[model samples]
Target: MFAPILMSSGVSIQLQAVDYLILAVYFAFVIGIGFALQRHTRTSDEFFLSGRSLPGWVTGLAFISANLGAQELIGMAASGAQYGIMTAHFYWVGAIPAMVFLGVFMMPMYYGSKARSVPEYLKLRFDERTRAFNSYSFAIMTISSSGISMHVLADLINRLIGWDYTLCLVVTSVIILLYVLKGGLTSAMYTEVLQFFMIVFGIAPLAWIALRDIGGWDGLVAKLTVTKPDALHSWAGTSGTENAMGVEWYGILIGLGFVLSFGYWCTNFAEVQRAMVAKDMGAARRTPIIGAIPKMLFPAVVILPGLVAFALTGDGQGYELPTKDGVPNYNQVLPSMLLHYFPSGMLGLALTALMASFMSGTAANVTAFNTVWTYDIYQSTIGRGKDDAHLLRMGKYATVFGILASMAFAFVAAQYNNILSILQLIFGFVNAPLFATFLLGMFTRRSSSRGAFTGLIIGTFAALLYHGFSHAVENPLGMKGGWLAQLLGQPAAFTLGTELAQTFWLATVAFSVTFLVNLIVSLVTGRDKTDAELSGLVYSLTPKPIETHEPFLLRPAVLGSLVLVVAIFLNWYFW
Candidate 1:
């Protein structure tokens, strides 16, 4: 049988002096960039959006890096081990299309309108109430999400190095605070580009070593066919629960591929904010397209490690999930793989890459929250008529607050059994409703502020109800066992599994309800927005801008098409 992951197994690898040297060099270089850019971040716009002067390459790398948080690093690998290769769909299906759509269609309105933040765009298109609702909720979500990443970092360190979790949290938080306070978003983006390169170099070696040890892709597949038959197939048997992932084709296609995917890539400010900082319209539009290229291929590095682990551990090959008090800890797959495969020096680089992932994600959220708070909430309402310098001061202060608040949330996440489930529910509640509101506001001129706000409220309520229904069956929680069951006309035994499948369906239901409600309310309210008000904000009233100086290869149409073609091929090849 395979050994458990605890250090008691005597399998833990030790780091060499050279490994610590590499980590020291990386930290020095990253922090050095922050100090170098401190001069340029004197103004609010430069502090928050890099003075809107970043090249497509820099913004594009950072755009994807910001989203590759603890969840992407740890969760994707764990999913690959547990749910098999189908987890790759999160990239090829759930990300590529929406990214392409954003680049080719949505960037025109978002970048051309010159809105400093996503909530600002809502204010321009809708009303004050709409903007406030989005701004406040988004701020809270970003801080909470950032804290969870900090917690993940601490937990990983505790597992791998036997360090105190509290110490790990403090060390990581201080590093993030130092760079963000000095350089703002400008420093964050530059460092994110550097992290992106480091992450590839760090993980790619593990993947190569693992594949070689297992003989190769075909050999790994042959082994999995015996140990984990369903793990090798992506879409072959996804129509029902016969596959490793219990989701159906409709669930994958409509629930995930459409609702969840579009909701995240299109509406989430963390990713969109990177594109917003581009030097020009062409650069902004090309950001996601450039991101999509690397994004489509990253599964090979992150996801493959999980598969390698599963194959190696299963049927008594090597290391296995650690059992703490008789329950298996599956989340340690990636770290455990590094310990098993890499030696002393290389292990430090891999761990540093992991640290970079969490830090990049946390910084992105902090910067985004600060921007929204400084511009949308504080400036628009309380600090009206403030000078740019005054607003810049407020933004820096908000960044500090954001980092502190996130650290607090990281402690709170430790109280939960499965923090990712809570995060997913938050996404369902926020992104689904928010996307529905944005969709109606952008595509149609008739959507009223009152109607959009109503849809948002109803959509959120619908998501909560669905999540309650799904969980009530598995674990009874007061009303979910009694009142909620009666309301749904189903018994507590009718519970659904609270996985990606449930989250996707809940988001889908919320989107549908919000879209219908918005449509009905807008039609009844009649056209409230004049063409002048809708200029570059609404689809029909906006005229396409000419960008003839741009090369044909870099055009949104060409890049988006290439992205789609590659996505299609990946899905088919895996099928």
Candidate 2:
């Protein structure tokens, strides 16, 4: 079923039986972690946050593992095939700044305030409505994202077992749910160490194969330079008319790179939950930067395979490949590549790589989602008087519910088969406003609950509208003689559908309008909450805090500044 991609230029895939056995053992190992860790589960906090017991390095590595999803290995590289280094702006511009900002500014406040969930912080800073709005919206987004994860994971597994893709999703989701249901973060974090290594091991062989195919690093670069010059050279993509709302291509840079970056890193509950669950102030403070080290190199591992495939395509060797309806299905490229290049034992290993991503992502969500529900929803709302066991039970129930719903959604998503589009739609509706509300809540004490809720509804609708109109415009462009079709022509086609920038813009506009609305409502209602009243929740910078105002000489603040400068230099030099 999945053999075509392995038949690369000349390499022969080997190891038919042993590889699959090792792969089965790998799955058994992860499941065993879940059951083994089950004995330690006692309370919601222990289950959901690994008892806040992880060291800085463990949490840091786990954090990186969680963030680098299965799609990232393929998706970003797929983007690189088309957009070059520009897509990495999601990392460079968005990720680096967010890491620094979190370390210097956000982490201190979150950890110091001792808030359990980011929305709990919001409630402290704003109002109950703010908490409720953010919580519900975040829950929906995360669950839907889980569905996509299920689809990808299921597809990867199906490639090996010849099972129905939707069935694969259901099985994988059930396994994750059991572990998550049993021990939550303990299972996730402890097992993340295993899943993380599996991914690296799987990629190791493929990278070797890629280099071998091109005859070594120098030869690969030289051949690639001639064939995919633009793919390697520029950090920026060309701008032209016929983008969404007639906006130029430059909008992608501004919207996806800048606006969306702030939202996801600063506000998203899935990522923020990690910081909240950190073992101590030190771990919370250092884990993100620790994670960033591997993350910086992640693109080289995750994206290079697709680039290899893209390179192969240009060489007259790949013309036979289908393009998922001619839209350059980056998601499928990894599977296709695996089928073509991996030897038998290596094939099991490559399949495991995909499992690593799927498991890591879903596990991260299961833990994070449970945290939000426990601290934000259940503790504060339903089952408020429940005992620790009850809360722990509820969290497990939440994990089950989360997985079951996502499996159903995954099945639906597979039938539709538009992972990126569904992802943008889901995030566009959820992320932009959450980003706006959180930023406002963090920076402005005057921000009211009314403001946050108002912002939430407004931001969500704006994204929907943006997606709606953008889709409308895109339909004509997909036609034979539309502006986009004519301009981009064949192969290097500027897909109107997946331009991430347009989605970001839609979210941004919605965010801006809703933010303005929140401000006006706050001002008009004049229901004020002073910073003094909210001190414990909002502005609780460390008692031993290094003054953000007075620049530190040898401080983390100083190191952060140094890092940003170096990142900027790298981008420019490489751009």
Candidate 3:
């Protein structure tokens, strides 16, 4: 029988001198970049949006790196192990198309309008109430996301190297705070580019070594098929709800692929802020499309190790998953793989890569948070007549507040086994409604501000109500849902077989309700902004972005189309 690796108050993995040296070098470089960029971030614009001066390639990598945090690394690996190959759908189906759409269709409106942030764009497009609602919701989401990254990194460090979890959290938070507070968004973006490369180089070799040990793809398939026949196929058994993921093709497409994916890539300020900093409209439009290329291939590095670990466990090879309460702690899959496969020098690089990822994510959130709080909330409300100098000062202060707030939320993140599920639930409440509001506001000028604001309120509540009444079969109480059902002394309205399914369906409910309610209210309330006022904000009134001077290959439409084709081919190949 296989035994799980139980957590103890002792160090599990030891580092050699070379490992310590590598780690020291990485920390030095990280802090050095912040000080190097400090001279350029003197103004509010430079501090908040990098002075709109970065190249497409830099912003593009940062765009994806900002997202490759605990969610992509730890949560994805956990999903890969638990749900099998179907987890790739998160990238191949849910992310790529939305990224292409953002590049080809949405960037013109966002970059053309001169809005500093996404919530500010809403203010320009609709009204103050609509922008306020989005700004506060977005602020909450960013803090929560940053906290999740912090929690996961601390947990990994505690598990592998036996550091005190609280110490790990405080130390990492301080490092991120110092860098972001010094150089601002410019610092965050440049370091994100560095982190992107570190993550790729650090983790790719582990996947290669794992595959080699398993005798390659065919060998992995042979082993998994014996225990999980559907693990090797992405969409083979997804037609119904009996699959490993407990989601049907429709749920995967509509809930994750359409609603959740579009909601996030199109509306979230953290990712969009990366593209907004590009030097020109052309570059801005290409940012997400460029990021799509690497995003399509990331599953191999991040997800494959989890699948390999699952296959190796309990096969009499003396490997087992770390366990909590006698259940597999899938969150440790990536760190576990790093500890198992890498030597001292390599382990340092891998750990630095993980640190880079967490920092990248946290910095993105903090920068976006500070911008929205300074411009959208503070400047708009309390500090209406503040000069640029004052606003810039406040932005730095907000950065400090954002990191502290994220630290507080880190403890909240510790309650969940798979961080992705909790994140999706948050997105279901926040992004799902926001996407509906953006869709109506951008595509047509008929959406009234009151209608949009009301829709967001009702839509957010609808998601909460649905989640409260729904439960995953295995996890039926509290964070996973069913609390309201318990309060009502009745069974859950919906019982999903998996936590992933429940979150997906909750997003679907939120989007559907928000869309319908917004449409109806807009029809009733009539147009709030006239055609002249909606110029550059609404798609129909905005001038078509011309790319005749650029090379055909560099055009956003061409690049977006090519990305879609490759995404389709990938889905077909994996199918």
Measured by lDDT, the strongest candidate is 3
Each model's lDDT: 0.84, 0.66, 0.89
Q: What shift in Å separates residue 8 of candidate 2 from its native position after superposition?
A: 16
**Candidate 1 Cα errors over 4 Å, as ranges:** 1-5, 8-13, 319-328, 472-494
For residues 229-321, write the lDDT of model 2, one tens digit per residue.
Answer: 666643433455432123343554556655566677667767766666777776676666666656665666656666666766755564223
TM-score for each model: 0.95, 0.86, 0.97
- The digit string of per-residue lDDT tens for model 3 on 107-194 reads 9999999999999999998889889999999999999999998988888788777789999989888888888877899889888999
Choose 1 or 3, whichever is better by lDDT: 3
Q: For candidate 1, which ten residues in a row score worst on lDDT?
A: 1-10
Report the Cα lDDT for residue 153, model 2.
75
Relative to the true structure, candidate 3 reaches a TM of 0.97
What residue pairs are clashing in model 1?
46-51, 473-495
| Ranking of candidates on lDDT, top first | 3, 1, 2
Off by over 4 Å in 2: 1-15, 159-161, 215-228, 236-253, 314-329, 472-498, 539-555
Give me the runs in candidate 3 sitting further than 4 Å from their true place. Answer: 1-11
Q: In each prediction, how many residue pairs overlap at the backbone (N, C-alpha, C within less than 3 A)? A: 2, 9, 0
